[model samples]
Target: MGRVLSVNAREFEEWMQRSLAACEAALDGFVPIDAPVGLGVAMRYAVLDGGKRLRPLLVLATCEAVDGDREAAMRAACAVELIHAYSLVHDDMPCMDDDVLRRGKPTVHVQFGEAQAMLAGDAMQALAFDVLTPDSGVAPALQARLCALLARSAGHAGMAGGQAIDLASVGLSLDEATLRDMHRRKTGVLLQASVMMGAACAETPARATAALAEYGAALGLAFQVVDDILDVTQDSEVLGKTAGKDQDANKPTYVSLMGLEPARALAQELRCQAQQALADSGLPNTAWLSMLADMVVERDN
Candidate 1:
């Protein structure tokens, strides 16, 4: 079984490399290397050549797993990434998390000035919808659904709302349930949407869709749990960002709230839940998703 898992992992890694290459090309084309002026440069800077691109990978992988339209999936993948990038651009501003390093480089607000970063984030959000609701290619109904899902995930009831909770909870005691709820909005919702959006690219059945949603939710929570663990265990250089920043900011995290060992256990449990969801998904050959679950937990950065 270990040998079989290794072989499967190798195959999925190859697939992920190819998909990442394709995603890079697509993102480059959508968010051009050049724009009209300074704002254009900032937009490109915030998005191009940074970060893990995990969300986009989820989109494409789920698309393939569901036998969806590759072209449409690529579009959705890039769109979701744009939203992620925008959030980071804004999140690093002085008003928000106020960080200087991201993806091992200067944060957008630091690199491009706060105003430019803000504008770039705004533009990127608009561009996400533009990419989704193109004049041709993807079906109109599907486009609408994708647009709606992205909006909800990125809007008040999702990532934005979670951020609000995070800002408010700093220096305040939060119960496990409240912390979990906050992460479900801030991080998990978008991740969940990535899977659902990919499923939407094809004619997935209701059962497969539900199972994928479960997998995505578990994976999302696991991602945050690992992030919290890395915040304590890894250094700034290894993490490509400020390590222990969460603790410094007085922000509540899995590690801070539940302790390091328990947080680690929670991540493993979430990983198991994610894998179980995939098994129950009844979808054929979810090797990529399974590998991604492990990668999210095992990654140091």
Candidate 2:
């Protein structure tokens, strides 16, 4: 059993600020401003100026861990964020979660009409791949690998498949195993793919890649568990989204299934698992990854 080393809080905060600034700039530069019919505005609205950019940070951090190519990692970071943003757009629509608020602002469908929001999501999804497959800088082979990883994670086998299960399972009793499976596809895969994509930016060894995958999976599940906890414990103003929506919708969550204290315990357990994976990875610089795992589980909103 491996252990998580202590991370300097001030150092982590400084790194986070720098990484976030870079990611925001990359996203703004990559997302176009000249699409026809006001589409560019909606696309930018959905992607820019909101959210924690956790996925992008994960991509960048893992890339640093492996000493990977900064250009490819940055592209991958922006691409993953695009996929995540697109998913949030569609997920908040009337046909889905029907959310009216996201990231403390009106949902995309509310800001833009539902039809426009739909198109924005569609365009962002396409643009994710476009960001990955630039005409220059990134090698063709590396581009292909990054695209394949993102596509599979965002496609039916990953996020979409998990969402399908989620919609159908609403108001239904889901055992722990079934619930885990649903979330693993819906949320975990993308987060895991972020790590793998970063690793792909350079020639990471097999052992390190495997360990990072394990770390990503554990951190992803831990993220959702903490989210469930926040839904019940935090309010909308604090959470920046609808609070208690899961319980209101009769959706099964870790908190609903296992009670609040147990769910909290589970989150800590998963965080430990993530830290253990990082320790096992044999990569020298995993301070950021370890701190991220802590941040995922300990986040207030």
Candidate 3:
């Protein structure tokens, strides 16, 4: 527990640098020369930009817990990040959050035009698969499974569906149940995939996959809970994105529905549920997993 919070920022920086470097190297070799190269640059712009890399890190960590091959895990890790990056690119569009800042820099739509941001997201969606099924070299069945997991997480069953629900809820009175469904789709699905994909790399049993899925769901909701808490307490500089945007936009959130203290309590409970799910999976060596759960509950950003 002490070591998790004490993770050196320098080590995290180095790890991210290595991950981004490899992702770029793979893209550089495979991207078609006929394409204007601008697309690749935009892709780089979105991906190379700063982030916690939490989702991909989860993928890698879960894979290790399952005793899977690390190299194969990289492909899924990269895929999840691309999907995450693409979602952020679109999420910051003028039509969506319309924020001008992210990771302490201009949002993609602010730096590039909205059209470019949309295009970049489109390209990333395709490129994510380029990383997964082909580059990873999992068995055909596993590749199919990975692709399915990603599709559900990124598409209607996951992020897309969540965003749709959220957008619809704007300016409307929503209850706690409504908010939970919105988050479950928008954030929960991808997170569930992060753990599932890692297990997929190791060909984990159905039971383990189910357990990890539960962990991801609980963690995903917990992530939203923290985000809600941060919106009220944290500043833009610390958050690296617009804060209080939900309140400003009149969007429904846990803090708005449950109040500050209860929201925090719920987040803590969700984190514990997530941690317990992993423990019940019967996997070993959960140091990083515990760290991740702690970070989700305690993160300022």
Candidate 4:
């Protein structure tokens, strides 16, 4: 994989196109027949909004890295994306960030009313759990494990909790440890879960899973740090969301704690640290793991 992050390359372009196509196919019959037409439309928009498909891709990649049947991981892959889409939809709501744009298009709330947007997010979340339940050749035990891990990562104790901290910390001076805690739960858990789900199919050793989880933790935090830096340096067009959104929201960030230059440096350090974790865990011989770490820093948008 060589860890390249730009989308203009031929191989990456092909992968993204195929992934998005698969994602759309998985969403077929997603519309609820009795739901109001406006609400159904909102649901589709939220689930189908264009993105890098990074979470699902991570699932597929990690499954392959650990010698599992990559195809068997398909449903799990889509499940991750569905949950991610649901989170983005809710995050953009007026009750949340109130973001006006997502992936360069009007946010669900901007196109559909707030009530419809909320229903769409709820629907998307339901669909995510439904996808994971399908018999995709995943063992019953592994499926059950995946369900528990993903739920823990998504519900009140994980991403939801992290989001709560973020909302509460707005305009408040927070120490770095507190900020990291908020991000690790809110963002890192999902990333960790994605990798673990893939590894579960492989039935890798406990040590391997722990190693990958360490890598996941470092990369997830690095991803967030870079995002904060990009908000300070990039524009809305390139970012696809409103840039400086953290600042406008008066949210404390890595950039706020340290200078932009230092934040960038920290992200780079974390990326390297993540790669080292993979190596220390004996997965370093794998190119894709290291490549993903590099992409965390080199991604342009």
| Per-model CA lDDT versus the true structure | 0.90, 0.94, 0.80, 0.79
lDDT of 3 by residue, 256-287 (tens): 99899999999989988887787777666655
Q: Model 4: per-residue lDDT, tens digit, 183-219?
A: 8888888987888777877768787788888888898
Candidate that scores best on TM-score: 2
Off by over 4 Å in 1: 1-7
Question: Model 2: which ten-residue window has the lowest total lDDT?
Answer: 1-10
Please give each candidate's TM-score. Answer: 0.97, 0.98, 0.89, 0.90
| Candidate 4 TM-score, C-alpha based | 0.90
lDDT of 1 by residue, 1-301 (tens): 1111233666777888898888888888888546566888888888888788899989988987899988888999999999999998998899999999998999988988898899899999999999998889989999998999899999999999999999999998899999999999999999999999999999999999999999999999999989999999999999999999999999999998989999999999999899888888878867788889889999999
Candidate 1 overall Cα lDDT vs. reference?
Answer: 0.90
Worst 10 residues of 4 by lDDT: 1-10
Cα lDDT, model 1, residue 223: 96
Residue 256 in candidate 1, Cα distance off native in Å: 0.8
**Pairs of residues at least 3 apart in sequence or in different chains that clash in candidate 1:** none
